[model samples]
Target: MKYQDSLEQASEKAAQVKVFLQRAGLAAHPVNYAVCYDYISGHHAALCTAIEHKLSAKTPFDDFIMADLYSRYLTPANPQQEQLLQDASGIVSRLTGYTDLAAEQVADYLQQLDFSLLQLQQQQQNGENILSAVEQLRQQTQEFRSGQYQLQQQLEQANQQSHQLRHELEQLKLQRQLDPLTGLYNRSAMQHQLELWFTEQPGRRVAAIAIDLDHFSRFNQDYGSAIGDVILSKVARKISSYVQSSGLPVRAGGEEFLILLPDVDLRSASEIAEQVRRGVEKLRFVSARSKKALPKVTISLGVSLYQHSENWYQFLARTTDVLTLAKQRGRNQVASETMLALPA
Candidate 1:
């Protein structure tokens, strides 16, 4: 009865989400639905407020509202923001090296000036020829100018190289978190975010939505790896977009994606998982070469909330177990830890 109620709730929200989009004069699109569903399910309080404000003002809604909502609700700060800050600061500190070199050069110039003054005094005291002294001074002045120019050129070259190296390093750090195939955050990125959520914010609630593509191997076998690759890319792209800012979307393994929702409970997490499932279900795939439609693809999701006492590994294991149970019960259904804990 509880399972049936959740499905009924999902069905109702899905309908309301579509109606909200239509009434707002927004196109019924994936990105639009992601925001509306989130709002309808109360996953995004701020979004709900924004929509209410527009309605209260009696202003006509436009695409700009969607864009604004997306930026605010769906666009999460980069999980690697702290690391990026450190990397950027490190790059900027390279300029300090140049400053130190410049200081040394200034000291050398001062020392040269003092030595020249001493030489001039000695030349005068020794009654040396004024013309010869003048010639020697001219030679020293030319050498000083040439050396200064050379030092300036070297500093400029060093600065350019430092910038290039910093850019390359930043790119490498971003790549470390990204899956090469699906363009989603890889396992390492998810672990990084989870560590931050786990250790930094001890009391905060965290939930995991574990997802796995159904009969993924069947598609690979029937259409070849190329089509399978396309399917994976499309699905990952859809999942990644929905979790853009609100959560961390990770390509946990082949045909499996995990979304980490910070400060969320099991109910909200399951709703988001269901939204993802429905979005993927509506996708239509057709082959280019043969001009034939491909088999419909679906996914199973398991949601589990973090227990204050259990570590993240245990939390993830429970979620994965829930996912296993979901498959056993029926593929393409959303199951939660609560469901798993129920008496059989």
Candidate 2:
């Protein structure tokens, strides 16, 4: 219930969020997505002010800065958890105080009893009373120790429950960063990974391949969205299969996808892209009811190496331009930045 937007309004905002992320070259990671969504909503004045300040200063958006902004502004403090911890601490403090007081009382009583024992040896009248007091003190000490043990167990359980709650929250946040239909990392996640890769290895060689399903919109229009979704999922899986463990595959909205290859050259990335194109082209979908083969699918790809001087968005834009050139020349082909530089 955190979001109150109707279906139409939410869809509109989601589209805008994509555009915003694309423009800023930010990942659609949960933190970045939340920040973008809230900013577009125009509801959080302080958040808006902070973002505007960064923009005015022309500060580039990085994962660390985005995470800081999210932690500072968007992340809601768990009041219940805070109160529980405080209450537990208070209990521990009080228990310590009581234990100290009990120890002092026991010490004083033991001292008095020892004196009384000497007196009892002389008087032999109140010996029974002193023994009875000692017995009571021993019983009280045992009961207090038992109570402390129980309280310690309860505190541990509460800590465990709090940890579980936090883990669940983290899992839920991660889910939001995935493309629901394609089951691939969304645009935000792609951005986040790009940032991390560059941060981990400064000036690392990276190749980006931008992919678009050829004539997908036309196919979607001819067939229903449900069928189109099936194709999209299959294509996503095909693209992901080629990436394996060496690269990141992302569903960059609509019928577009991206593959980011670190430690891979442009030529190697192009070969992989070509393989994906062939793989997707080879996949054959059959109509469930009619038992007829569906239309053949193909993809256009653009490959580029990350330039040291360029930001991720600029790199993506240039790659996309190459992809655009492929589409313009003809669909279902591979294009590279070198080709893009050539005279038309």
Per-candidate TM-score against the hidden true structure: 0.66, 0.67
RMSD of 1: 19.1
How much lDDT does each candidate structure score? 0.79, 0.81
What are the RMSDs of all candidates, in order?
19.1, 7.7
Clash list (residue pairs), candidate 2: 27-188, 28-188
Candidate 1 lDDT over residue span 128-202, tens digit each: 855765666677678767767876886787677677767867787788678889988876677678888768888
lDDT of 2 by residue, 161-206 (tens): 6676667656655765678899888766777888998999988999
